[model samples]
Every structure is written in C-alpha cells, then in structure tokens.
Target: MPSSASAPSRARSARPGYRAVLRAPHAGRTFGAALLGRLSYGVVPLALLLAVRDATGSYSAAGAAMALFGLASVLLSPVRAALVDRHGPRRALPPMAVLYSALLLAVAAATARPGTAPAALAALVVAAGACTPPLGPVMRTLWRRLLPDPDLLRRAYSLDGVAEELLFVSGPLLVGLLLPLVGPAGAVVAGAALLLTGALLLVASPLAAPHPRGGDREERQAGADGAAGGGRGRRAGRLGGGRALRSAVLAAAVTGLALGALDLMVVAFAEQQGRPEAVGWVLAALSVGSAVGGLGLGALDRPLPNAVRLPLFTAGLGVALAAAGLAPNLLLLGAAVALAGLFVSPALTTSYLVADEAVAPDARTRAGAWVNTAVNAGSATGGATVGLLVGHLPLPLCFALAAAPALAAVPALRTRDFGGARSRRKSDPAPDPAP
Candidate 1:
C-alpha cells in the first residue's frame, strides 16, 4: 500500500470527478451512511415541531421549545466536535448517536399523546439537541482522508453540500409521507431509527477506522513539534487563530445571515403580492439554483483557488439579493432569489475547503464545526433581526439590508490565503495537499 505522504500525489494524478470521488475505496459506503444519519437533522426538526405543537396545543410553546433545542444544538456543536477530535470518531460517535437517538425516541413517546407538559418536553428536546452528533463535520473531515487530492476534495465538498441541501428538502417530504400512515410522533420515531442505524453503519465503514500509529508522517511531525514547546506558538494556534479560517468563518456567517433574512423576506414578498402560496415555489427555486451551482462546481477540473472563489461567490450572492429586492413582480423576485441561490453552496463548500486546509488533521473536525456554528448562529441572528426590521422598514429595503452582510464579507474574504500556507495561489496549476 502507498504511504499517507504519497497518497495526495497519486490522487492529484487521477482524473477528478464526482464519480471518481464516489469510486475512491470506501468513499461510497461512508458518504452514503453519513448522509443517512444526517437526514435526521432535516427530519427531526419538523417532526418535533409538529409533535410539540400537537402536545402543547400552542404554537408559541412549540416555537419556544424548538428555539431552545436549536440554540443548544448550534451553540454546543464545537464542544461535540472537539470530543470527536480528542477521542477519535470510532470511539466517540456511537455513544452520541445512541444518546441522541434515545432522546428522540423519548420525545416521540412523550408527544404521542396530547397534554404533555411543555417544561418536560422542553427539557427532553434540549437534551436531544445537545446530544446531536457532529456527523456533518466528521463526514467532511473523512472526505479529506478519503480523497487526498485537492480537486477531488473540492468536488466531494460540493457534492456533500448539494446532497445535504437535497436531504433537508426531502426530509420534510418524507415526514409528509409518514404522516398519513403514522402521524407526527411516528415520524419522530422514524427519524430516531434513521439516526441510530445510519450512525452505526457509518462507524462500521472501513474509512472510519483510526489511522495506524506512525502511518501519518505529517501528523506525527506536528505532534512532535507541538510537544517541543515554543514550536506550538508558531503553528496555527487554535480554530480561529489562522487568517484563512477567520475568512472562511466570516464569509460563512455573512452568507448565512443573507439566507436567513431572505427566507422571511421571501415570505413577506409573497404576502405583499397577494400570493402567499407562491412562497414555496420561490424558495424551491432558490434550492434548485443552489443544487445546480453545487453540481457545476463539483464538475470543474481546475477551478479557481478557494481564496479567489470565496469573495466572488459572496459578492454574487449580495448582488443577486440586491436585485431580488428590486424585482417588480413575484416571478421576477423568484428569479432573482434563484440567482442568489446559485452562490450559496459554492460559497459554503469553498469555506469548508478553506477551513480544512487551514488547520492540522487533528483539528479538522473542530475547524469545520466552527464554520458550521458561525453559519447557524448567523442565520438565527439574521432571522430575528429581519423579523424586527420587516415590520418597520420597506420590504425592498429589508431585502437590500439583508444583502449588506454578504457584500461586506467580500472584501474581508478577498485576502490571499484561504488555507494559510497550504492554500494554492491563483497561478498554481492545481491545489496540492499541505506538506
């Protein structure tokens, strides 16, 4: 077998494509299982929301419970990711999956019948959210291992992002399917089952196996360097210490803010046009545009360096959103939103790529998780901010305001290094793995 140091060279020489990534040994099984488990992230929220509403008989109570759940999940993600980095996925993932699954099952049982106490339900959901496994970050980190070639890794990230977008879309549909047969609580049960089964199968994949001691020369050297005291000060200190990661996190947060605000703004636009029902189609257009953009990015053989691409994507989103605000009619608004969507996945995928390249292998999970948290936190903040602004400001102005963060992020993201010393320059023939 080739050594870890030589793997990137071999991968670089191979043709890069979505198919090639899938064909990488163990990639298909690992990715498939991760997606299966990740689907629960999509499924559980709607299921739990419905169940909570049914149990409490008050939308306000249900919304409050979900808010606590989402806050706990988003805020504590890095902690969970740190644990994975500390213990290794094989050792850590299963327990989290088990606990998270059990909690969801408990939530289902409690919500199966009406009159469940809101406080008790809130506690259960909060615990469940805190236990939500960091599968997305783990899977992305594994992708780096599975595909050492930077091009392939880029495609993998794009594919992963697109798959995730589709998963969230399909999740609600899946719940809808189950509702006729099983109802809301049963949908929650089904989500729990999916999470447990997928997580177990993910760990069972060969790719999830720990790297043998001494197999990774770079990590070994990094470990040695860290142990040597003063050397640690010179290395990227922590998740946020590096410039590249900061840029990624900033871009991610801004883009997320734009998206979160856009969601509410779109609904408001539809309502203003006397076509509230058009909201779904407009949002679906955004998703479809994102999927297309992601697939287009994955198909590239020699795409622009992440540093160069990141700013452009963010700017594109900002300009598109600004245009969306000017649309005179609902159809035009949908078109403009779809245009904005085109940048969503590419920007996020590039951010992940930049973050992965910014840190050492040991810190990969935490690095990715930080970016994940920034996006979610920014989204939550944006929604709340826009909710207040929409009632007071013109809807068009609100849309333009939503575009501000993404536009502002462009300059910050324009820096030369998106992966610290590992990032490829614009003139480089292709990206190479860090030495």
Candidate 2:
C-alpha cells in the first residue's frame, strides 16, 4: 500500500492510456450519441406530421398534433432532466426511450382508424413528447464526466454544437427520404425503431455510466472548502431555485423571440421575389455557417470566459441578422443569414455551459430544459412578431426587430460570481465538478 501522495503519482502513471481514451474513445461516444439524438429529432417531426396529415386529411390537424408534441416536450423536459439528475442517465434513458417508441407506434396504429385517428394522434404525440429521451442534456453531463480537461470539454461541446446544427439540417432531409419509401406510416414506425435503438445504445455506453463515488465525494469536499474560502462560492450555491428559474426564463424568452423572427424573415425574403425555393437554400446556408463556427471552435486550443464569449457572440448575431435583413439580393441575404447563424450555435452552447456552471447539480437538467423551452418560446414570439411586422414595417426593420433579444442579452452579461472559479482553477483541465 503506497502513501496517498504516491497513489496519485501511481494514478498519474496510468493517465496516458486514459487520456488516449478521453481524446478519442470518449469523444466518439459523445459524438455518436449526439448524432443519433439529432437523427431521431430530425426524423420524428416529419413522420409525425405525415402520419397526422394522412390520418386526419388536414394539414391543420397535423400542425396541431405537432404543437401538442412540442408542448409535451417542453412540459416533460424538466421532468426528464430531474430523473437524470437523481438516478443518472443509464437508469432514466432506456425506459423513456421505450415509452416514446411505443407512443410513436401507437400514433401509427391510430392513423389506420378513421374515427379515432385525430384524438389518438394528439394523445400519442403528447405521450411521445412526454417520454422523449433527452439525449443532449444527458450526454452533456456525461461529457463532463468522461472528459475532465477544459480544452477537451470545450471541443466536446463544440462538436455537440456542430452535431446539433447537422441534425436540424439533415433530420428533415432524412425524413423526406424515408417518407417516400415507408409511406408515412412506415416512416413513423421506422423513426420509433430508430429512436429506440439510439437511446438504448446511448444508455449502455460506458461514458454514460454514473460517476464513481470517490469522485463525487472529492467534489463535495472541494465545494465545502471553496464555500468557506470566499463570497463567490456562497453566491454560486445561492443561484438555485427562483434566481436560476428567472435567468432560464429570460434566456428562453430571448431565444424564442430571435428564432421566430428568423423563421419569418426567411419566409418573407423567399416570397419577396417569388422564389419560394430560396427559403430552403437560405436555411441551409444558416445551418452551414453555424456548423462551420462549431467546427472552428472545436479545433481551438484556448478557451474564452463564457461571460465574455457569450455577450460578444450575441452582439455578433444581432449584427448578422440586421445585415441579412438589409441585404439587397437573395445571395447577399443568404450570406448574411449564414453569418448570423454561425454565432447562434456557439452562443447557445456557451449559454448552456454557463447555466451548467451556475446551477446546482440537482437542478441542472431542469435548468437545461428551461433553456430549451425558452428557445422554443422565443422562436414562436419571433415568428408572430415578424409576421405582423412584415406587412407593416420594412423588411430591414423586421430584421432589426428580430435582433432585439440578442441585443438585450448584452446588458444581461454582467459577471456574477457563480462559484465555478473555485473548483475550476485555470490550471485544471476540466469543468468544476458536477455542478
């Protein structure tokens, strides 16, 4: 039995192998999980829409079913996060995946019944949404666990951001491809199956396992010492409950507003010159730019403070949106949209990272879910506002208006001591433990 000091040295001797795994093996799992998660999100929405439309023979009904699905996800996300926090990802993910898959199949089955199709579709959508496996938040927590180096963590998040962008861009495309083959009903069934496979794979991955007790205990001790050391730790711990909820709400509102405006602008711009196809190209350009930025960030060697990075990114996004709105031609507008989108993914990734650092471990999943909900809400608000303004105001004005939330985030970027600094020494490679 070596002394405690000798034990760390001995542990250090074993680290080269672990580092190799962290650099490649762990990253592969994280990326795989992200890809599968995105694939499911990408496929499921279209499948649902197609199924609902087929069953009810109305696009409106399909849209309503989709809305219900969104509502289910928004309402249940926190609950899923809470489950992950309490029981760990492994325990929570598999069952939810199974349930979601079953509900998707139920929707497929209901579509065959003319009388019960509409109600069944709605119910199934809600059920599927409620049980939807939250791969992003869970995988993020896993990333923190498996890759403890700060630079690596940043890269991991950057990769995750890129995967997300790809998902938005590719999910619909995959759904489109599958729809013709599976005939809407088969597509929905396939999506459910795919989701089930991915979720189970994610749950079983070694990276997704619960943290070892020794690590957890060490973190608690460090937190206690840090809390005793200064006001920062005190404030960090205090940012729970209402304050955390408020911040999350504000962030979500801003996200919803910005996204909605962007969606409206895209449609309006495409319709401006009667080139309906331009909308797809413009959206693709935006996603491409975001993916490019995420890739760039993933390859970076240095990390910027979130307090600094987030505000800068937000401001950049606003400028890009304004430019996109003011562009004279479709090409120019597409370029601006792409540039604006570049900042969006990175900015969002940074915000979530900050929220992860700021909130307590117990509340982390809920915090993340709240952020997601805020984004959706902001997107809805933006769409509504842009729709109203497109007819009344100039297109440039609408773009500027859409940029408001990102602009607003600038003022809110004031640095508060979120106790992350204590455990997160500049010398240390990973994020502050768990919290």
Candidate 3:
C-alpha cells in the first residue's frame, strides 16, 4: 500500500493519464458490461414473474420459483468463484454466459407448452441460478486490478453501486414497457441476449485480463502439488482455512435478509393504505435516494473511516426504515423510505470494500461472488417471511418487523473494525501511557 504522504502526489501524477485511459473504447466496453448486467437483473425478476405467472397460473408458484433460483444461486456462488480463480475469468465466463442464455430460451419454450410448464420452469430457474456467471464479482475484481489507487478503486465501486441501483429502478420498467410489444417470453429472451452480449464484452475488455500475482501462482502450484501427492485432506483444510471468506459469507447473509425485509415492508405498507401504487413510488424513492448517495459518495475526495461510518449509517438506516412502518401519511412514508435509502449504497459499498480488503488478492472474485450470493439469499428469505406475515397480519406490523434485520446488524458493525492496524494501535495504546 502507498503511504498517506505519497497518496496525493500519486493521485496528481496519475489523474490525467487515468482519465484519458478511462475515456477509451475499452472503458466503454466496461460501461456496457455494467449496463447490461444491471439491465439483465432488472429484466430477469419481471420476466420471471410474468413467465411463471403465465405458465403456472399462480403468483405463489412464481414467487416460489424465484426464491428457488435465489437459493440455488447462493449455493452455487462459491463454486463459480472457484472456477474463476482456478481457470481465469476468460475461460470461465463464456460457458456460464452461454448456459444462462440457453436456460432463458428453455424457459421461453416451456412457457409455450401447457403440460410441461411447471417442470420446465423449475428446471429453468435452477439452470439460470447456477449459470449466472459471477459477472459482478469478476468485474469488480478486474476494476481493482486495473485501478491501483485506493481512492479511485473506492470511487469505481461506488459508481458501480450507483449503476446497480439505477438498473434496479430502470430494468423492471424496461420489462414492463417491452412486455406489450414482445410478450413475457420475448422479454425473457431479450434478457438472455443481453446477458450473453454483456458477458462477452466484459470478458473481452482490457480491464478483465487475468492478473495472477506471484503469490497466487505459488498457492495454485502448492494446491496442485498437494493434490498430485494425494494430500486431499490437507488441500481441503487449507482451502477451508479462509476466515475472510467466512466473514464475507456471513455479511452477505445479513445483507440478503435486510434487503428482503425492506422489499416486503414497501409492498405491505403500500397495500395497507389501499393504494398499492404507493409501493412503486416508495421503492422508487428509495432507489433514487440510494443512487444519489452513491454518486455523491463517489465524487468525494475524502471518505469517513469505514469503522466509524458504517455503523452510524447502518443504524440510521434501520431507524429510518422502522419509522417508515410507523408513518401514517404517504408523504411521511416517502420521506422515510428516502431516508432509509440514503444509507443503502454506502453500506453496501463499505461491505464490498471490507470484503475486498479482507480476502487474498486472487480470492477477491470469489469473495465478491459470496457477497452477491448472500445478498440474494437474504432478499429471498426476507421476501418469503415478510410476504407471509403481510398476508396474515396488519401491514404496518410486517413493515415494522422488516426493520429487525437492519437493527440486528448494529452489533456486527464492530466486525468492520477488525484487521485494521489503526484500530489495533488505538486499542493497545502504549500500555496506557505508562500509567
């Protein structure tokens, strides 16, 4: 790591050339990849909802299929990351992309047939879940490798977070618009096509090239040596000895649950007022707020210490979300949603950064995958539990309940302070100044 003293000098020296490089065609490819990835995410949820609803003629079944997909993705995330680490992204990305596209086509085909619909939809969900190339993770790893400056890297990740929020807002809207013209099956196919095109561009971009450090190669060779020597148990033990990986996985799970609850709360609150459309507006307000926060954070030259910032922001977010449930008017609820959203992108960005700093360089991709998987898993869990509660209880009660996960996260904020030398030094404090 560069010293604090040299950081500004390095930034001044690199800024002009970095800007020029970022303006090149390859950078456009990076943006394209990001755009497509977000678009695919946006399209998939709506398309799945529509296709499953059309095929099985049940909203519950559709939701179940979506949940299963999330579960499968969570389970497969590590495996996908392992592949990216072992073979390099170039070799790993294409097959996953192809499989993802093919699965969508299969789903489209299944929707056309009445008798075979259920099994096919289930199969498609599983395949889609398994085959989702660790695009977000891979892309993030590439960005880190390509941009060496810590601040620049933070900015990139923050921008990506913003882009992700934009995608969430716009993707579904796009699907809604396209549904009339192309039908649900066609929208699904379009999403697949986008995924394929985006994945290819991402893999081909200059930033996406493999950058295995000397230590990474050594670790790989050692693993191979151990395997060839029939030291399977040793190899397994070494791989499983990743404390950072465990931390990332836990964080992901927490994030997933929190997002899921947030989703349920929004819908439940909207329905409670007999103005279901308010749900969309509230969610949109949240998304817009998150996007604004991310962009503003990214543009900043200085950032608050993650240790201090994360807990404060997250706790504030929890309080805001809780307030939204208690809000009696639409205007107040909208404000609450916006307040809750203000911390979202920042919180997620901090998590990603922490995960990045925690893991070994080569393992970063996998670590990121773990985070994404956890997010999906959490969202699914939140959706199911909150959905069920809303069905049986008062909507505000369900909304209030949704804040539990975020509230639960307050204690975990200390986890962010770990492995930091400054934190350690502060705690140790020179034997309390010799008493």
Candidate 4:
C-alpha cells in the first residue's frame, strides 16, 4: 500500500532550538532578505554622499542630498507602514520595492552624471527613500505571527534588535571595502542591487502572505469575548487614540541621540590620534558588544516587562556613556564604548516591546513605523548638533550632552501611562465561555 510521502520525511528533518526559528519554513529567506534590506540602507547614505561629491565636487551638495534622503524616509515611514497593516506584503512590498529600487538607480545615474542638476539629485534621493519597503515594521509583525508563545516572541524581538545592529556595523564596512575597488558609482550600483535582491526575497517568503483584516481566529474570538479588541470604547482613550505610543517612541529617540553622540566622539578621537583608519575597528567593537548583550537577553527564559525594566535600562545606558567620555586615553575610551554598547540594543528592544503592547494588533505596523521614525530623527538631530559642537566644546563635554537625553528619558518613561488599554478591559462584562 502506498503511504503519504512527505509527512514522515519532513518530521524527521525538522530542526530545534532558538536558531530553529530561522529554520522554520521560509524563515531563512524572509530573515535574510530583511537583513540585507536593512544593510543596503546602511550603505546608501555614506555611499551616496561620496558618489554625489565625486561627480559634483561639492561636499555641500552631497550633504544636502543625503539629508533629503533621511528626511523623506522618516516622514514617509508611517504612511507606508499603514499600507502594510491594511493590505499586507503581497499587496504592498513589490510595488514599493520596485519604486524604491528604481529611484536608487536614478540617484545613482544622477550621481554619475557630472552636470546633473543639484535639485534633481535631491528630488531623486528623497523619492527613493520614501518607499524603502517598510521592511523593519513588517518584519516585526511577522515575528509575532511566527512565534505564538509569549517567551519565544520576546526572544524573537531581541534577536531582531541584534540583527539591526549587525546591519549598522556591516553596511558601512561593505561600502568602504567596495569603494576602493569599484569607485563611488559602482559602490552605489552594488547597494541598489542588494536592495532589489532583498526585496524580492522578502516578497517571496511565506510569512509575506496576507492575513484577514483584523487578524486570525483567536484574535476575532478575543474581540468577541470583550477583550480590548471588542471594548474599543474603553481602550479608546489610552491606546485608543495612540497616546501610549509616545513614551515608547520617546525612549527610542533618546537612545538614538546617545548613539549618535557616541559615533561622533569615536570619529573625533580617531582624528585626534592620527589614526583615522582605526575608526572602523573602534565602531566594530561597539557593535560586537551590543550583539552579545542582545543575544544573551534573547536566549533567556525569564524576562522583565518593558515598563518595569525600561527606565532602569535607559538610566544604565546613560551612566555608561557619560563615563565613557571620562576615559583617560584612546585605548580606555574604546573599552568604555564597548562596555556602554551593552545596554544599547536591550533598551531599544524593551522600548519596542512596550510600543507593541500599547497598540492594537491591527495598528502595530504603523506604530512600529512611528517609533522607527523617532529613532532616525533623534539620531540625525544629534549628529548635526555634534558637527556644530565638536570644534567648540571639550570632547568629554560633548559626550556628556549625548548622555543627558537618555538620563532624562528615564523619568519620562516611568511617568508615561502605557498598558492602560489592556487594563481598561478588565471591568467589562464577561462574555459567554467558549464550548
């Protein structure tokens, strides 16, 4: 008698453990694509600036284009994320990806043309960034879908944060490595290719498939049972109008400010020491520490709720960064930066979890988008401030300025009212029990 062919073989071939999440059906393709997509973003700003500078012979023009790119991405993120929440990836990703990649080509072409109009280059930069696949927000939503168990879900978020740091660390390195061999235009061309490839792979993932508008069966059932899903009026005031998300986004914003300060301090230190080449390794050390801390946090069985832990994490990060500025020499400064890096991703991860908790299931993608925008905005602001201050202030004082926002956020985070939406549902009349 012929038996069903694939079931026994599939069961026998299954993998296990935390890494097994990647081995889950289509997980590798989805995760890899998201990772590469983020990495390309990392490469673009620096590479595009150099490319534009080479063609135009104007650092100011290059800076203007890069700034426009950032502005567009931050401003447009929520709108794109809302589309993802409403239409899902199949309906969303391909078109945005194609448009974004095509604009990158335009930007690349503009950068290669010696006499291209400055305003034209600026327009291309902004338009390209406006539709960057909404990849980060969509990936966060997918983690929730793939991991039903609460513990596993938290772990997945931690891992996701770690992945983000890897993109930061690797993106610049790729550009640096390729620039010497390929020239600025060629490096940009490579980045555009990577973005398109990752976008296609992401769209092909099984998780990219659409879910019903509200969510799956259990979500609907929860709503029917007077959960926050059904008690929309009660949840309306808190998570209802999206006030709770502000705290989470603020926390992320401050973290970004601190990170940007650290970045400038590292560069200044390297320049002072006459070892500009060493800048890469110093930054790499910081990234490694973040990855290590995030991995340890993600693998743990026990976890702290975001509200209880977020303030403490932010405070710890602030203290460490302040102390880093006081280090006696370059060697000690690198050590201090690496030590401070330990708290970076954990704080962001906690904030993300907090943000996710405050929003309804249907609103999470857009919520994530808002938080991400706050992060980039703060970073850009801080970096610009550093550029102005690095020549005027003492180096240690500059670092202290970065640390202040994070420390200030500690009190802000504690006072912010989150989880009110869920708690509000407790007083509602009980629905009939499920059969």
Better of 3 and 4 by lDDT: 4
lDDT of 4 by residue, 322-369 (tens): 898898777888888888878888878777766766655556677788
**TM-score of each model, paired residue for residue:** 0.91, 0.85, 0.83, 0.87
TM-score of 4: 0.87
Clash count, candidate 4: 1
Per-residue lDDT, model 4, residue 264, is 86
- Weakest 10 consecutive residues of candidate 2 by summed lDDT: 422-431
Better of 1 and 3 by TM-score: 1
lDDT of 1: 0.86
- Regions of candidate 4 where Cα sits further than 4 Å from its true position: 1-17, 212-243, 415-435
If both were scored by TM-score, which would come out higher, candidate 2 or candidate 3? Answer: 2
Q: Could you give candidate 2's per-residue lDDT for residues 1-435 as a string of tens digits?
A: 559769988775654332343466656765575577558887888888987898889999999999889878876787788777666677888888888898888888887555555776798788888888887777776676666666666777677767776876677788788776777777788788877887887877877765567443444444444444434444322324333345445654665577678877888888987898889888888888888887676665455766577667778888888778888889998899889878877777776666665555444565666677677767766776787889888888888888877787767764553314533431122345685
lDDT of 2: 0.70
Q: Candidate 2 clash total?
A: 12
Q: Report the candidate with higher TM-score, 1 versus 4.
A: 1
lDDT for 318 in candidate 3 is 70
Instruction: Write down the worst ten-residue block by lDDT for model 3.
Output: 423-432
- Which residues of candidate 1, in runs, are more than 4 Å off? 1-14, 214-241, 420-435
Give the lDDT of residue 43 in candidate 4.
88
249-363: candidate 3 lDDT, tens digit per residue: 5555665666678877777667767898888888788888888777677766667766665666667677777778788977788888888778778777766766665444545
